[model samples]
Target chain A: MGEFEIFGMPVSLGTMIFQAVIFTALIWILKQKFLSKLVGAMESRRESIDNQLNLAETYKHEAEEELLKQREMTEKATQEAKQIIAKAREEANIIVKAARKEAFTIRTEAYENERRALKGRGAS
Target chain B: MHATRPLVQIFGLTFDLSIIITSTIAALVVLVFAYACTRHITAKKPGKMQNLLEWVIEFVQNIMVNSMGRKDNLFILAGGVGLILYLFIANIMGVPFSFIAGADHATWWKSPTADAHVTMTLAIMMIVYTHFIHIRLHGLKNYFLSFFKPFKALFAINILEQFCTTLTLGLRLFGNIYAGEVMLGILAAAAMKGFQSGIFIGIGSSMLAAIPMMIWQVFCLFIGAIQAYIFVTLFMVYIGQRVNEATT
Candidate 1:
């Protein structure tokens, strides 16, 4: 080692170089094999989570819109049903009034004709 | 203690074989651990190892984001994970057992991080990489101008600070791990001395030393993890300084 010493410890260039190489190799191998895989997995998982969240948000919005449309349709149908019932009641009242007037007229005419016939027989 | 490590001359450079071996062992252990923790990684249903690995990655991500403000730097994130894993594993490698062999009692096994060479090399590598990143991010001219930032009078201080950063970053880890191992060695020697003196005294003193040793080992584990976190965090902070300097 040619008497190289630092702080009472022998310093060797070979050992330093060897260790540096080992450390570099360690970093390269780990980066290539393990860290990349883990990071990739994490990234994909995050992307999927984001995608699912976005999908849920859109679905919720669509469901709300559909519920609103169904409510409006039900309201319109109820209003139309009320209008039809009111028109049917008005038509039934008019028909019953006309029928009662016609029956009263017919009874009056029959009574008058019978009285006139009795008077003629007495005169004869 | 041996004055020199077992040296193997190769191509005019003297290599410390023990550091090489222990470091290789530490590196292999890290590799195996990484594989074990990541073998069955599932995005949906993660296993225990997967969960731990994910947690570590997330932790590193949080550190980077905290420092750099959500900048997308995958390379740095990967390096951060590698750094923390390797450092934590290497720092604790000497806690369980140490191996010394031959007549000179050459150390065959220990934490590679306990040695100044490995730690300094790591520190240098990180600093150099940081500079490279700085240059790549802000151009060479900007990086050069950064040394004189806010005024021209502080250039020397800025230059000195870089050296200080490297030294402190390396030596802090070395100092902690080395102290830990030195104390462990002392305790082990005391225990051995107890066993050598007599059976009853050996049992008593050995038991006495065992408590401290166990406690030190646990403390070393905590130190290892903390040091790893600090090292990686500081490295990120340095990178963050470079990356966010333009914006700030």
Candidate 2:
């Protein structure tokens, strides 16, 4: 015989069909059990990555807020420094004016006293 | 010469040794390269091999999203990758040694896809899986209604479309690859016949003809890969449509 026959059917045909069935079964099992687990792992990995992205986003927002706060603080500090400088200038100006007025008064009193003493000596 | 026998039999099944060896070596090379590429994957910056692999992954992803939409059927992405890898390896099985690899073999296990049994099995799986997805997504009532047309006269046409989709998917791949193998075999036979006459003339002609055939084979390899991709993409689209209809 060319090949074994079963019920006048060639064994090769039966073998091919059997192999196909087995292969199909193998793929089905892989898809059901193994592939499901693989998909679960993939999904978990995706979730982790997404969670990291969210954390990064939160960090970015916090950084932006911190930067804004720093800017506002710097601006406030600069404004305070300007006000203090202006106040100090005003105080220095007041002190200098008072000292100049006192000096003028002292010089005038000394001149008057000297004139008075000269007049008494001349009389003597 | 027995030691250099071309055929090997296992479990009453015969296979061409040259084809088996060549395909195994090719598969090993691809597997090793794929593993090596996987090891170097980094989110920051990717090397050349990593970039190439990522590009392929993204390309397949694009195809999946386009065909299936970016919804619940993302699981099909893995299937698409498997299809592409298997088809690519099987297509390039005949590349080395002047297309004298699995394509030239005349036994089981030669070009795993060239065999009708293998292709039909894949087709059956895809078709059955699609139907299973459909039934699972949409209960039996709506899924069966997909076959019924607006008019009763068109019911047969609608049913025919489903059958044709499965039939064409299997036949198209088989037809393309089988024809390619046949062409390569004919060319190899002609070259051999010419070689028997004289070395100088035979070598010159065969080399001249081989250059174009080699180029064509390369093109065929790409076509084979594309056909495989198209098949799976269509399968995903079918499933996606069913899921969409069910949701709506």
Instruction: Tell me, by lDDT, which candidate is best.
Output: 1
Off by over 4 Å in 1: A6-9, A60-124, B1-4
Q: Per-residue lDDT for B145 in model 2?
A: 84
Per-residue lDDT of model 1, residues B1-248, tens digit only:
44346778788766889889988887788788889988877667678887888889899999998998873678898899999989999999999999888887888789999998899999999999989999998999999999998789999999999999999999999999999999999999888788889998889888999999999999999999999999999999988888887876
Q: Give a tens-digit lDDT track for model 2, residues B122-179.
A: 6767777788888887778877886764667788998888788777777777777767
Query: What is each candidate's DockQ, to 2 decimals?
Result: 0.44, 0.09
Q: How does residue B95 of candidate 2 score in lDDT?
A: 42
- Cα misplacement distance, residue B130 of candidate 1 (Å): 1.1
Find the candidate with the highest TM-score and give its number: 1
User: Model 2, which residues run further than 4 Å from truth?
Assistant: A1-69, A79-124, B1-61, B70-77, B97-110, B139-146, B241-248
Interface RMSD of 2: 6.4
Clashing pairs for model 2 are none
